[model samples]
Target: MSTLPLFPAVIIDFLGSATAIALSFLALRYSWSLIRLQPNNFIWGFLFYFCIAMAAFSLSRGVGHIIKILLIFGNRNDIWHLLSPFSGGINTMLMISAAAVTIYYHKGLQAYKAIRSEAEKLSEANTRLSNSAEQLQMLNTHLEEMVEKRTKNLSESEKKFRNFFENSKDIIYFCDNDGDITSINTSGRNLLGLDPGTTKVNFYDLFCHDSDLLKYLDELHHNGFVSDLEMECKGKDGPTRHILLTANAIYNEKGQMIGCEGIGKDMTRLKTITEQLINHEKMASVGQMAAGVAHEINTPLGIILGYTQLLMDDFDENSEDYSNLKVVERQTRACRRIVADLLKFSRQAESFKTSLDINLIIQEVLAVTEHTLNIHGVTVLRKFDQNLPMVFGDSEKLHQVFINLFNNAQYAMVEGGKIIIITSASKEEVVITVMDSGSGIPDAIKNKIFDPFFTTKDVGKGTGLGLSVSYGIIQEHGGTISVKSPVEHPETREPMQGSAFYIRLPATGVANHENEENLYNGGNTGIR
Candidate 1:
């Protein structure tokens, strides 16, 4: 130790101390700048703190070296040697920790660089989204304008179609495949006898001859179009109308027949006049013989009845002669009735057309025949509609018609039975049905029952002309009278014992027919 060069050694220790202090200060300053860059980051911030501690330890070590040199100058090398190991150990540990912190800081810097690059990409994507939003807004505005323009055009088209449909002069109609009227023009409704605001009505119900209607429906079903088809239809408060209709089948997009559409030209008045001319010609020919028939038949028939009555008075009550006289007298009276019917049939009386409630008419007829009905052991059941409208016709003539029908029903029930009478009305027509429970008429004779002198009764029982006269009277009133035998009672569900006579007549408005006072002004009828 004495042989050592003290001057040179002292100079080296001071210079090393100065270098350590300066380097420590520079490293500390660099680490502080790094701490500012990533102050909250664990990897970088902890690395900077560790490096700062290492710099401080290095600064202390630099001071320790200077102290050792001072101690060597004081000849205290043992004390200097004792602290040198401590200072060296601290410096080595700080150097190793700083190296580890440096590695971690480098890894964090790489991760931060990647995150910054990703943020730049996100900014570009946001710019593209803004451009797309502007394009979509322009497209939406154009679509709204196009939709508004199309809607206006469609509305105009529909308006034009509606005008054409409503203003046409001819009657136009649309019906379903089932012959239900779906839509009809004003003229069509008027011709078909429907009031304004009629809810729903069937198409085939408008036709007169059911056979003709059935044929027409069959044709339409097969062909899907009907051309120049002439048919009769009842009109609103009017007579049966003749119409020449042309129709086409309507179809859906799938080519199925959804409905039918048609136009009808009215020919009612013309057809009626033609038919009247024919009927008048026939009547004129029949009237020529009617007078001679009355004159020729009355004289002999009166003489035979007189002589038979005289003979009947002379003979005993139980004798064969009296029985023969009774037979002759019975036939003579029947002959008289036949002549009376002929006269009435030939001469069509002037119709007293006035509105009258049909249900009231039924009650009156029932009143007149109720005693006779009780004698014959027949029960009368009346089910009449409460809202039936008044019908237009002659009340006296109508009364005669119902009386004949009721008498016929009485005759039908030979044994104790039931007679059900029903009356109902629709917007256009009034219906009356007289049903009896008795032995039904055979179908073989139904067609001929209305012919003159046709009878299903015993020799003295029926004049046969009763039904014929009834048929003629109903026709004169511009009504229909039909019969159905062996029909099931709608309500009772029993097989009706006899026959049904269904009569339909035109319904007249109460306000329009001022001359009529017979109509029930309040309600139509009640069950009795």
Candidate 2:
């Protein structure tokens, strides 16, 4: 054949090969889609085999034509006859095998139809028997109606119970065996701050602490119920919820414990009030004793200081008597300072709460301590929010709190270091952090820092009342003071860590503006 004719044959060969590949892919999709319908059926096997044979035959013929074209056009005569085949080729053999499978499948299909027809006849007979049974069942219509009436009554009772359940002020909840909230009332949902749209809520996530919840669950399982058990739960707002939880296991008719039902009475506000009252009484008792002791020592301290000064006047500056007199004077002076602190602690000074800028108080404390801090080579940085709202408290008392903190930070770093004073406000509270880049308070001593008479300073250096007094002042102001050590340095971000004192004062929002205005209008309690 001419090369021109061979090109046409070559084109046809490629087209046929492409067509075969496309057909094979279509066949694969059809077979898979039908896999669930008649899995491993004989008819399915027949169709699969037929598609495979057709794909192979078409591919082989197309390949042979291409080879023939190449051999004729490229002047390569070494392998010409191998690809040529007769009418009864390998494809024909494959078709014959597929035809045989198809015949076998036809037989199987006939048997299946026969079996299905027999099953239909059997089903028809069973239907007649079922009809007779139904007629007998019609005789008990009065019994079914009576059962329905009883069910309606029970449903009404359930409805009444549910109405009370949903309307109660106390939280009520139902949980599955896995401690998952299956259903909860609006009060329970609101208190727990649960997502109203969520269907399944994990029960333990509502609590302040996880380990406490686990212990309760274990106890409930052992006793089959828990009654008036006090537990702390996280609230929707900032404060923790103190709940008196009462719960019991719910069992099915077969005595299988499936879930639990519970009620939670919120006692957070009452508990806080009780705690504050107790703290006040304790402070009162301590203060009375402090006053008595302070009065008893102050007279003697004053006498000793006066006598030491007179003795020093009588001796020369180089004499041993003058040096000894100086020791007496120094010790007497120290004693007087301690006495003064005791008196201050004893008198719960009349602090009239008024709206005052906390930042201004902090700035005043900084102004007093700025020279001392600079002398000790300690740098002071301030980051106060400009729009910080005024807090309702005594400016003098808050001023004292910051003064104590500043003095402590100054002493903490003997060598040159940085101290950062940051004041920021959240939605509910104003936070002030005094951070010092000095020797960090170790974990062991951290907890005792605010305890009275607990000092890390040398014997003659510190009486350790500074932190304790600061703590008391903050607590009295309805605020919280906490210290965390080994915090990352704000500027350097180094491992040589520092100490941070965090004071959080509750913020009374825009409404407090009107309150402050009212206070100014009502009386002049020295806004200065």
Candidate 3:
């Protein structure tokens, strides 16, 4: 045991204390860096305080060791004794502080772990809340879009219904319980001949007859609806219209009848067409029957005429028997003539058709009938358009038609009158009007004038076949014959105090001048 071992021990002690102090200072510096990065962190703050305590302990112990070595080398034992206790006490206190701080650091670490877990849970909750908020916004947007689309669809449906209501062709109307009109469409207004601005009108007043209105209301009241109920409706500016009406009773929330709504289909034109078709069918049947009867009666009529003539020859003149025989002969001849007219009316003879001027045919008819007309105190007037078109028809048949019209005019005016013959051209047809300033035909018999065996004159004066034969001839030539009486003035539709017969024939589209010369010379003309 020498002083050499003591020097080695002191040197070891000083080096060990300095290494501890350096390591503690480096640890404190790193802990300070951790604190700077997370200043409020409990773990880092606790660790930094523990590092400071360790550093202070290491510095105090290392300084005390170095002072002892210096003191031993300088042989200053008394001063070493004085400084050694204070340095040792300070190192002890720092070691205790470092140890206490290390124990408390573990408790702080447990608290820090709990705090970090709570923070993570809070972060997860915040993330979930954000997602929920975004989903809510998306749902709101989708709901808004659905609402907007529904609104648009509703608007479109309303517009379509409104369009149908306004533009529908059928007469649509609504009326109140008291037969007062409430609302009506454009077609309804037009059908009733109402003004554009008219709103209120009595439904009962629209009916052409009161009986029809009463019947319609009675049926409607008995049943809640009416379908295809036919009725005539009066107009403000025209004739009554035929309609097929369908209606449903309108009701309030309490189911009490408030009014009625209906649609009316116009059937006026259809009714006219039906009547014409029926008339055509009837004429066809009558013509067939007439032809058969005329054929069957012709031979008997001829034999009766031959026998009557033979009887007349046997009787002497100025005798009662002779007079009676003459009467029989004349009546037989008249019957034969009627039979001949029936044959013509039934279209039994084949027609000879050619393109000819209607004016030429009329002139020829006048040539034959002018003398007769003048004798009857009837004057003839002509109104022929110069640029007349050609018509393809039988000349003989047309001559018969004009002759018949002239004779009727003469008979109609017993006192005397004027007869006018007018010829004009249209776009596709030729129009001829035979007008007479005589007594106009009675309205009751006007429609019957063209029926076979129907006549207004006394039985012995006429055979009642003239107009019917003319009608048949005109029909065979694909023309129309219509009568108006009293004849209307050309400009004003007022009556001209006479009767007018209008004939429309299809044009041949050929110039009338081509056949004008041939017509006078009877070139292929059948007017014997």
Candidate 4:
């Protein structure tokens, strides 16, 4: 094989040079167009086409050299001779330079694209941030406006509350748990007779009498509120005024107690009017009773006077008939005793006496009525304490108490029931329990049983004043009467059962002695 290759090699080198130049120009044109396009699309499409064009050009040149060597020259000499070393070197240099330039241009373009894309992204991000900032500013403005509006409403509410609190007519005061006055409104200052600058006055010092102030304050501290509490306060003139106080407690948001506020109203005028009404009612009832009693006593007195006059005028002084006249005189004396009881009831008298045995008075009253109970078939059960001490009371009045109780018990039992009278003594008091197994008192009448002119009996059968007089008598003796009705069966717990009346009396001897000492010492000076 003749190595005649210089001419062909030159020609091949020229063709490869032409092809590389064409490829370089095409790549340059494509890159220029890509640069004019949008950054994202240009960068992506340029990278894809650059890789494909490099591979296609390399493959085409390699295959074309292989085909010439195999079919036309048939040996490695033809390849070396037809494709000159300088040609290949030049072609490799051109391809390498072109590829490097393409790569360099691609890298430079990519860097430029990255810079431009970053700038665009930054521009877009700045635009979004600006929009977000504006929206946030608007939201913050709206929130601030809402907060200001709420603050204004709260201020208005506080002003209204202050107005109401300051303008209230009631005497309102705020005090600490220790009963120290913390704040006093205008009405409260006037009520307490305190000037605005006064801070030395203790509320406890205003109590008219020494009382359970500490106990009352402790109750306020524990209960947090007090309603309808009645107390007496000494005014500036040293006269006491009655007051009704209603109080409420103040607490903080954390549920911690701060202080108590109280409103007090003067009740002195109402108390005076109530006392006057009570006295008027008593006077009216007494007048009516006095008229009836006067008539009752007048008839008995007329009969006694008529019989005494007949005896005095007709009977001889020394005769047996005169002894019979003495009997008439004794009967008249008994009639006078009855009239005396009626007068005692009609007139409110300080008939209290000393040195009386209450149990003995009860026995005497029972002796007078023993025949009556026996005739009525009512069994009397006596559980009297033999050691009952003597009481300082009017013997006749004490007798009347027992007579009234016994007669009521007898009247209650129309069918003949057992009457149990129990008398027990204590260190300070005596208890008398009168239990009757009779028709129990009705519920409707039980509360009014001791009230004046209250009775369930027929009009003629009772004067309706027995229980009332008994109550008055007991009250004067410093005793109490209470009734408990076990209106239910003990086992079944059913209703409408029997009742028991309990009378409690302070034992007369010791208490009366103490009372007399107190009276002598001016301790009882306040009694009206």
Superior by TM-score: candidate 1 or candidate 2: 2
Single out the weakest 10-residue window by summed lDDT for candidate 4.
Answer: 519-528
lDDT score, candidate 3, position 456: 72
Overlapping backbone residue pairs in candidate 2 total: 0
Global lDDT scores for all candidate models: 0.76, 0.76, 0.85, 0.68
lDDT for each residue of candidate 2 in 1-528, tens digit (9 for 90 to 100)? 655544666787778776876787588568756765878565665676667766666655556656667687777755575545642376577667657766777787788678778878889988987997787677576678878999999999999989988899899989998889888898888887766887878777777777778777887788889888888988555446899999999999998889899999999878866865666576667667777988899898898899888878999999998998998888888888877666666644577888777766776677687788889898777766666777888887788788878878877888878778777788778888888888889866765686656788888788877777777778888899888888866555666578999999987663223343332232222211
Error of 4 at 121 (Å): 16
| Estimated TM-score for each candidate | 0.40, 0.46, 0.63, 0.38
Model 3, TM vs. native: 0.63
**Candidate 4 lDDT, 1-528, residue by residue in tens:** 677756677567557755764675566567657756755565545654564555445544554554544545455666557666655665476467547647677677878778888999999999999999999999887988888999999999999977776787666777775668887778767766777888765677777656545545656778877778788887555346788888888889997777788888888789866865675477458746865876677687778767786877787888888877777887676656545544555545568577765555665777788679879987776665555655656777778777888899888888787676666787667888777667887655655676556677896566666776677677777788777665443224556345667777777543223233322232111111
Off by over 4 Å in 4: 1-342, 347-352, 386-389, 452-454, 486-497, 508-528
Q: Candidate 1 clashing pairs?
A: 193-235, 193-236, 438-497
lDDT of 1 by residue, 1-528 (tens): 368657887788789878977877787787778778868555556656776867777777778778877888899999978988997887787777778777777677788678767777888888888888888888787988888899999999998877776777677888887888888877677666688889888888788789768767776778988888888876657667778888888889998988888888888667756765665565556645665687688789899889889889999999998998898898899888777767665544456767787777777777688778889898887776666777777787788788888888887787778788887775588888888887887866766676656788898777666666676777777788888888787686766568888998877744233323443332223232
lDDT against true structure, model 3: 0.85
Using TM-score as the measure, the top candidate is: 3
| Segments in model 2 whose C-alpha atoms lie over 4 Å from true places | 1-223, 231-245, 256-277, 348-364, 375-377, 385-399, 411-417, 423-433, 437-451, 454-458, 471-528
Number of the top lDDT candidate: 3
